[model samples]
Target: PRGLMSLKSFRDCAGEGMKAMMPANTILVLAWTISGVCRDLLQTPLFVKTMVADGGISGGLLPAIIFVVAGFLSFSTGTAWGTFGILIPIVVPVAQAVDPNLVLVCLSATLAGSVFGDHCSPISDTTILSSAGAGCAHLEHVSTQMLYACVVAASSTVGYVVSGLTHGSLLPGFASGLIFMVVTMLVLRQRNKQKDAAQA
Candidate 1:
């Protein structure tokens, strides 16, 4: 009986397939969890107040700022849902106070930013699962995806700005942002081609 079963067969039967996958990645998993907790702890009320302060930050800029801030928070925490839970309540009231009209745009920006950051963060569960599912190194997956994430984020930032300026009308902002993203990608592709040619 023992001779008939190979190590691979035993591993498949005893849940070793799942258990073996975790030992090497335990440190990384713990580190990510700790960092997320620390980030949440440090999200202070003063920071929220400063971000929404009306003197220097105009209504037109509010959405863009919220996007940037939410992105940073989500990236640090590696959790888009957590970022949304923390930010939406604060964003809504502050945006309403600043300009009741800008509230919807600001909320939209916040949600988009959270997703953008979580998509890119190495510590995010989706990112981890994606790398694992692809059977690639986690860091390799993160590095490869970072460029695209940054490009999308920049486009979203521009879109949020336009939406805020237009009093929450997203169509024009969305169109312009799409155009900007396409043009930027084309330019980058051309540059990469030139570099490859030079190398050759």
Candidate 2:
């Protein structure tokens, strides 16, 4: 019986695998470095004190702000994991200092925003791979998905605002978001129907 794989074959396969993973590995390393630096900065008493003193990012606004920032960063970078690594460390300490009760809500917002960005970002690896796997044009896939992603994102932003304002109450935030999403979708569908009728 031939060996499971010849030595040369195995080496070539391993090399290819490493080459494929290089970009992801580089992003992970960079994200980790940024997180570490953020953690160190947060540890400084002066930094923490200053952040707490900054009245601009009050508890009522922190979740919405974090969500937007995390979403923007993840969209630009095209990697949710990197966004998580970069934002979580910074957001955690800041949230705790600003409002301990908001820590969990802020964390959830960060994760949700990162995922939302990754879902809609054209450059995201998952988005690219999904299009490739479906044998569709990448831009077409991005464009089609963007509309729904934007709707969800809008509703989520509202939910975050409500949750933050309510001091982390989950029900009101969730219900408001769900209702907003449903109404938005119904309106879009009706408008599309009217436009189609007019065209026909």
Candidate 3:
């Protein structure tokens, strides 16, 4: 019935400040935050532990490896969101007690790892939907998506390292590093485009 913000002038509320910065996608961030809240609220600890079995918690590399295995299976199950629902509650509190300072770092690792698992799995719903939607064979979707997810996951690990060093702040920290990732992706895209153009 009503159009959403024909003018969308935020300067009326916060001077020219909001209009000058982050105007195009603040709503997207807000929507994501709301979704995160819903996910958190519905998260159940017992269910999480049920999904995460006891093993590597007893020793060194084992715990980390266990997380990796869990990440892979949960995601391959075609439900990263569900996998996260089953892991974060179990991971977060223990991670926080281990070191309050590294909370975000640990969370990012867990979340991103799960996404890595789910996105490339042949049976994953998104993977299936993507192939079906694009009119491509399912294996092609899985194959191509795997390459990008691996690269991004590698970048994300480096991002977590930088964010941890700087206390995960936006100013001269996480935000600045994001610019590097964006630039890297853009340059890669341009290179591919040029190669395609030359071949054409």
Best by lDDT: 2
What is the C-alpha lDDT profile of model 1 across 97-140, one tens digit per residue? 67788888888888999998889898888899999999999999
- lDDT by residue (tens digit), candidate 3, 1-200: 26544445543656576665563245345444544664467453333333333532321122243246546855656666666655565566644444455566566666777777878778776788789999998887788878877666555555655555555443544554467678779989999999999999
RMSD of 3: 12.2
- Model 3: residue 64 alpha-carbon error in angstroms: 10
Deviating ranges (above 4 Å) for candidate 1: 1-54
> What's model 1's lDDT at 136?
99
Query: How well does candidate 2 match the true structure in TM-score terms?
Result: 0.88
Each candidate structure's TM-score, on Cα atoms with residue i matched to residue i, is 0.74, 0.88, 0.52
Consecutive 10-residue window with the lowest summed lDDT within model 2: 41-50
- lDDT tens digits by residue: candidate 2, 1-200: 37999899999999999999999999999999988876775464336537656745456778988899889999999999999989888888777877787899999999999998999899999999999999999999999999889999999999999988888889988998999999999999999999999999
Candidate 1 is scored at a TM of 0.74
Error of 1 at 130 (Å): 1.0
